[model samples]
Target chain A: MDDGISHNNNNNQILCPIKPIRCIVKLGGAAITCKNEIEKMNEESLEKVSSQLRQAMISGLSSVKICGMDWSKRPGNSEASPTVDDFSDQSLLDSDRFIVVHGAGSFGHFQASKSGVHKGGLNQPLVKAGFVATRISVTTLNLEIVRALAREGIPSIGMSPFSCGWLTCERNVASADVSMVAKAIDSGFVPVLHGDAVLDEAQDCTILSGDVIIRHLAAQLKPEYVVFLITVAAHDTTGGMVTKIWEAAMIAKLGIDVYIVKAATDDSLRALRGELKGNNVPEEWLGTVIRLLR
Target chain B: MDDGISHNNNNNQILCPIKPIRCIVKLGGAAITCKNEIEKMNEESLEKVSSQLRQAMISGLSSVKICGMDWSKRPGNSEASPTVDDFSDQSLLDSDRFIVVHGAGSFGHFQASKSGVHKGGLNQPLVKAGFVATRISVTTLNLEIVRALAREGIPSIGMSPFSCGWLTCERNVASADVSMVAKAIDSGFVPVLHGDAVLDEAQDCTILSGDVIIRHLAAQLKPEYVVFLITVAAHDTTGGMVTKIWEAAMIAKLGIDVYIVKAATDDSLRALRGELKGNNVPEEWLGTVIRLLR
Candidate 1:
């Protein structure tokens, strides 16, 4: 409700369409929740981060926010072999231009690791259960994040990756049918996506990371900025923590600036809001930058 | 999301259930959006409704809330005629027990009326398109309602009725397979359902209402009270405006006390949370109480 919260860094010559700044914000589970707890959400952190995004949106910037579910699931919450995208498409139809995707975190990790679904190339019962559990875990978090955004007055819709995601035989995201996502953004609704259990042509079903989703979207949408928010601080290792980091690098070569907020804070948000000195701010210059190797 | 916001209304003699007090809060389209406009959401009204529900939840009550989208859609939002409920199950895995179902207000009305899908007698091309369009409209508002609840930190998962619903030849809800809803509620998650274009054995497709969803859930779950929040405030036909009345009479036969909040106000929400004295309270006793004629 602040009267003066419009775009502040748009004039930096970041190249793209003539409309609002089409950006993507990624949230890591660690940043938004207590990683050790089951379905635990950090309201203060989430509110601060959401308020920052809200500020950006109000300021004339258009972006999609994705959350990483590194550790947000509780066990015994899944049932049978279930696909993840059953409820995704319709959500895309009416979301604010902000697209979101989150990681499976605790929800799928045990099952995925137990079933060896993450590594792909398996059809064991445990792995099958892992796929089901993974979908449940990620989706559970997706609802949580969606509800959080709803409270924030941001019309952010939840899209299960399996609903629009497809993977290669090698366990990488092959397709995410993001046309609805594109349309949603164009129409001004935030489409929320998350790292989820996706059906892989080769591996049966595999993990699709929020990072991978961002890269694919950057390539497809060709947005001005692909921003990543790692709520949980990693051990100085990027790319490896999330899926398809190398692919994101390839996207950066496509002339898109990939910015990462390793730790989402008021200061970093302010910095992001502050215009870049030029179109090409060095990758290191940006906080938690995820550089696709040139 | 908010650590302290669990259902506080259950401790009182909220009636029936040995578990949490299961209730349904129905939001008429008029209560949350401008019935006249296309895809426009009344944030103020929605906020009021959401806050009240949040209050009830915080007060120790377990319930499923449904939003009515009987008139919440415009045009040009459909793509390639997609089926709703693409991601339905995954969401239910980790949702709060508060179940939600909204009317297909604006989104489905036109196509539904044009194709006569509501009548559910035949299958024609327009009816098919109407099915798609209607699904999109209802889904659109489903996302809106989900977003609203998300903002409130209530992990309300959206469910497409068609995903788990079926209609009989009479065009009424034959089955809604709300097992997932029951599970979510048992697990303390809110399952958000909405009126949608569900498949019919005879009519091909039919319009499902949030009211019907409540009635259906009442039978299977046997919640202590079937509470309906008529946000539209349709005339002064009953308790003030939208709380209790006729539709509830249809549900009272189940031996459940029916409470209606004609409008989303503090008093009504308080009243809904208040204990119902006997098996029957006078109509004027509460905002609007419906007693089935013996």
Candidate 2:
């Protein structure tokens, strides 16, 4: 009745008994804004975040995956141009074996909304202006991010849901191959993904949230840990807290050991380090989720 | 006696004459701004000029060299950031055999004037500011130019007079090891040089012009032909046509043929058909100049 959730010696199919925890750290936009103030993004805070990530990777963590919302300030009406410093966050992101997925917030949301796509809570926009804008924004952002990562000597590959032929309707991604993700991980390369809308056979077109993608990946791969490096703490309500709470709830319900951590903060970031040091997550979740398979 | 110029006809002494002309076109800043009108740096006109150069090269006329100034709107300021498009002239300058040497007009001049390191004239207060500004600007400009060339699949090496230990005094290069320039050309690579003022052995520092460098080179190599593509025709202000210019004069005196030709005009550019046309200068003069062995 344990439903393969609990540890058993007979389930030798598991790669490692002391499953090396491979984590996917989701850094919420709210947390980024909270630590550095939403008014202006600070380089110091970014560096602090990068340093911590680097430490986590250097400590022999099986794998660390980082995801965040695209907080670039360029107006979405025109094509967004991310500066070289935009990817400065990679200083930490490149420290270990990690994959990154980002959300389109300031970069694509306004354009999508203006185009009358991703609006009305319905999926019927004939032209799909929102989708086209989102795709272009994501593509540009991905290129910049890839260049930054490469400059940092990290082998990173950009994978788009659209490129993979994943179809979606509204703001939801119906399906994806996911095999590409696995392949990138297997090849020691960091695969970068972003929250993007794609054509879906079942639902027309959908927006695939980074949070949802991480959950689906965890459910399948069952990584050792799932670290949510949001801009705010788990209980913060400044903005987007409702969505964070909902995501945390769903992840907890899935029975996957989850940690809602804040990036580069005095409190939560310290807690993140302590959690990794103490190895506090349940043994069952650790065994199934964390695998040190490199 | 023609004792100053040395010509060794031995085949081994010949430094790959038949080894495709890796000519580095050093376009003068005057050509970019036509001396009389800095505001008239026309892209369309320059484009035509570039087209003509390309045609000449394609017709087995050896390689064409171009200066970054040929594409710039203003003479480089020694104190500003170097723009990438400032070297757009290189688009046509590029080929399997071409080399380029660009000038730091505004970038270098601004620095020199501010620092009071006036290579041409003494302006104490201005020179003080110019020194620091020019140092920073030249480095910045050179880095940008190198990056731009690399982006276009042209590997360019930047050598600064200061870094190379070549100083200038009173508008003259005091001393320099010409080996660097020779090596770059001999190895089939593009060596980029710029107008710079260096600490001079005699006068403290001097302005070194690209034209002067080209003149010295003609004297050294005794190439079959020495062509100077200037903004204006070879005419003295006294209404006397100088069939023989300074560099051309020097080369001709050394018994080497020389040709001073203006860049193609708009009309000439339109009529260009990729033919190998000869400069109107007499054949005797042309033959005495070094020919592109390729």
Candidate 3:
């Protein structure tokens, strides 16, 4: 699989550098939830996505090693090089691993919009109500997704940001302790996260979109690829496809390959395997690839 | 409720201090789990505890304000004092709030003990398996507790430390980001945490008992009171009543009051109310009171 390392600057000195992440899959809320209905989950779509994920894990897609990493060969950087001992192979045990971040389609948007939760005013009663309602809604969806994955024999743990100090200040991510995510990945558990109502330094509270979460995780984990499972159509209170595309571009800027693929299709699997690598649009590939223009 | 404030040295400059935490309730594993059987929940006991918690919340047990604060009058501190603006009333809204930490009795002890997970050797497949198994077992129980709380109309969210960077080095808590717990309390949601496996720097992994979690939180949150819900008898892999009492004494040394009350009794409600204060053991109190010597 070409060592599964992208041609980008991986110069960030991450704490305790582990193996580069293999892939990050985003299950769009529309693909997994009945957006028109209140808090309704499209169980069929969720089941299909879970099954595909199970197949991908069992195929050993995440245990690949990124070789040929030179401390002094990276582009546009001048730093003291480490000794040869630092470059020793730290191979991980054979454990299926990946991360899943889902969105709040119908589950949380209703309560969030009604309470104006994204605006953040703790002094207001409605905002507090909205925040609680939105959390319950999104966390419930996260639980269902974990259950679906568990039914397929996947060890998935729900890791919501709201209660884990993934806070935003002035609507931008101020601080997020990804060490837990790193440890979970290192321990071979599929940590499932989602869009959640988080504490904001400027605004009292705000809805942290799943797209932002994906960008943050990619930057931190430096995954080789990110796959977005797109649904046909749906109502969304956060944003539309344009926002997703913009988020994807931002992630691509970090040198991670981003694929926006149709959900419940063979291309999803192809994207997971890093098999859709072509500059030209191929008829067989059912997704658009976003990457740095090399 | 004596404004629900303790005599503890509140000199620690917490990041953006909100109102003080009212109380921290420890729901013993034996009280809510069938210790003799694997993965069995004592639904009847859970329902009773949940009902009592609901009663406490609806009675406005968490909203008492700690008045009469003069930063200049505090003892044993020679730090610079902040202006009056720093001590401005940051009173939280009248949303019932407290933190709940539960133990893993039969649910997780089997998996953890069988795998010798506390010893921490990530290279060994058994330790890794034990990590995943223990996490799954405890998290499943946390979900049940949240469900029980929700059924009784409590806005409870499961916040497990294993998936949130709550790490221990050499069996002592190295770091715990309590900002999320603070934010949840400020926003009026009851945060439910549990004992589980966490990453260790010295050891590869180890069990983080609920008692240690209580002490860590007590130091950070500085709640007015702490209540330990005790069961008559049970098997515990983490530690038994002795460890719990030791943990309670440790909390008491911090100048905050601690109570060890029998579960399924009205004394639990009394502990939550901070109404059971006496040096002499009252026969009607039905619990042991641990406190610092004046």
Candidate 4:
């Protein structure tokens, strides 16, 4: 069951079978964690999102999930840096019924890139150390993320992808036993997960990306609304503040809509309204996503 | 696999096979979080524990594992209380090679007590609702625990025992696939787990105690050292503070020694030294635990 490479596995008995008008709000690491720097977080931005979630639950969109990652645009740091150890460990985002998945930024990329872990199938001693390093780094950040959410009164728990999900031979998520996450949501508790180094059936271990997790979760959880909040000035999308994803094929396939937004609170809240009451959201609340994956 | 329990089933290949020196640090809910209040955490106490771990790693014991649960005590609160929703999810504890399992305090006990989940084999619809409530309550506390540990620089991740470990018809931990936790420890990241409401093999869903989890982990992981950090005042051991546990029969059977401590940080650090480098710790740093189950 822990084998890593069997992508697109499904079980109707599990994976959010209820289809409750749930929403997944993704806060980009760059947006909240200051993409350019190492070991930094945007408290103000995170606080805003946190408050929005508190208010939204009151507004009736109680079944919601939030996702984010420790995404970064690093200029490279010397291992000698005093704070280098701190960069690898971070925490996650918040919301009611939050199911968070974060990317490994400064924490994971360095060791993974060094050991060439991204190339797949590591069998060497030192390379295995790299896998270990990557887990330490990303999970370190996961701790911080969970802590930040806790301070804001959002009781969030961290679940390592390697512990809960397996990667495929192609270095993609084959199967993630995310029923725990779903169960957490059903009980109204937030489940904070992050993209980390995972055990691969074919590759031994590999990186699982946050975007990939988001898509996979979107399909399985069947959240009626999805919002990707890219929280950095650097990741300004072409379609502007709100990019409505036009992945007709995906929407038709999964029966869910996605958006890349500069502002997730308003968009997700509106999307939730559109989902719960079937109300027509104002046009201004639309199109904040990068559009379809294709 | 997601079922609550299968019972005392052991698989050495997947479980802890080697007799590495590991420690189980149990942080009582009252120690770190104000058990009487809703959603309040003790930062100073948690910070002290975090630093002790950092120093412990610096002193040579690197293969350390930490386990704590969201244990709490609460006066009766009506469902009508707005804050009842906030206590379910909590945070975690500290350390590098950490595995945390917390008990449900005010968050879980209320619902589980009402649901009779502990009696095992729940079949009624209302009982099912009780299971759901327990999960929400406990997992909520898990979030806070993870967050607190993260704040203190522990790269902690959450795992729901309900999903990972199963209970027997008798409600004991049947089996828990904790390989991910071992892998996390191997990688130097702490795996934060909590007492969760789970679907059982015999019972539909039931509450799994942190103590049961600790015992199973000790047996499977085969840690040379184990400590039960009971932070609540309710559990005053007859032996007084710094009680050296002489569960000779169980120790002989399991080949592992455990201590029930009141002061987790110093006592655990001393215990780590005693296990790692064969240092004689002072006798005063013992006892700190309440009564243990015979």
> Which model is ahead, 1 or 4, in terms of DockQ?
4
lDDT of 1 by residue, B117-183 (tens): 6766332433433444455556667767765675454545565555332344466665444433443
> How would you order the candidates by DockQ, starting with the best?
3, 4, 1, 2
TM-score of each: 0.45, 0.37, 0.78, 0.55
Q: How many backbone clashes does candidate 3 have?
A: 0
Window of ten residues with lowest summed lDDT in model 4 chain A: A66-75
Top candidate on TM-score is: 3
Top-DockQ structure, candidate number: 3
* Candidate 4: Cα lDDT at A151: 37
- Model 4: which docking level applies? incorrect
Model 2: per-residue Cα lDDT over A1-294, one tens digit each = 122222212111223212223655664534332232212233354456545654554454335333221211222324242233443343332223455665543444443544443442222222232344344444444444443333233444555555433444344443444544553454344566666654433444455666766655555455555676655344442236566556555555555556655567544444344464334544433211221222
For candidate 2, give the lDDT.
Answer: 0.43
Model 3 misplaced regions, further than 4 Å: A1-16, A36-44, A57-97, A150-155, A234-237, A278-282, B1-16, B57-97, B150-155, B234-237, B278-283
- Which ranges of candidate 2 are over 4 A from the true structure? A1-21, A30-44, A60-97, A119-127, A143-155, A169-172, A233-239, A266-294, B1-294
Arrange candidates by TM-score, highest first: which order? 3, 4, 1, 2
| Backbone N/Cα/C clashes per model | 96, 66, 0, 78
- The 10 consecutive residues of candidate 1 chain A with the worst lDDT sum are A3-12
Model 1: CA > 4 A from native: A1-294, B1-21, B60-97, B121-123, B231-246, B277-286, B292-294
Error of 4 at A171 (Å): 1.5
Query: Considering only chain B, what TM-score does candidate 2 achieve?
Result: 0.55
Worst 10 residues of 3 chain A by lDDT: A66-75
The sequence of per-residue lDDT tens digits that candidate 4 reaches over residues A1-294 is 222224453322255634463666555665556545444556676666665654554343334332221111112522221122231232221234546666554456655665655665444433444554566556566666655554343545556666664454566566666666675565444566776777665666677766666766776676666666654353432232332233222432565556555544566555433342233445576544332333
Candidate 4 stretches with Cα past 4 Å from truth are A1-5, A8-21, A60-98, A104-157, A165-168, A232-252, A264-268, A275-294, B1-175, B182-210, B219-294
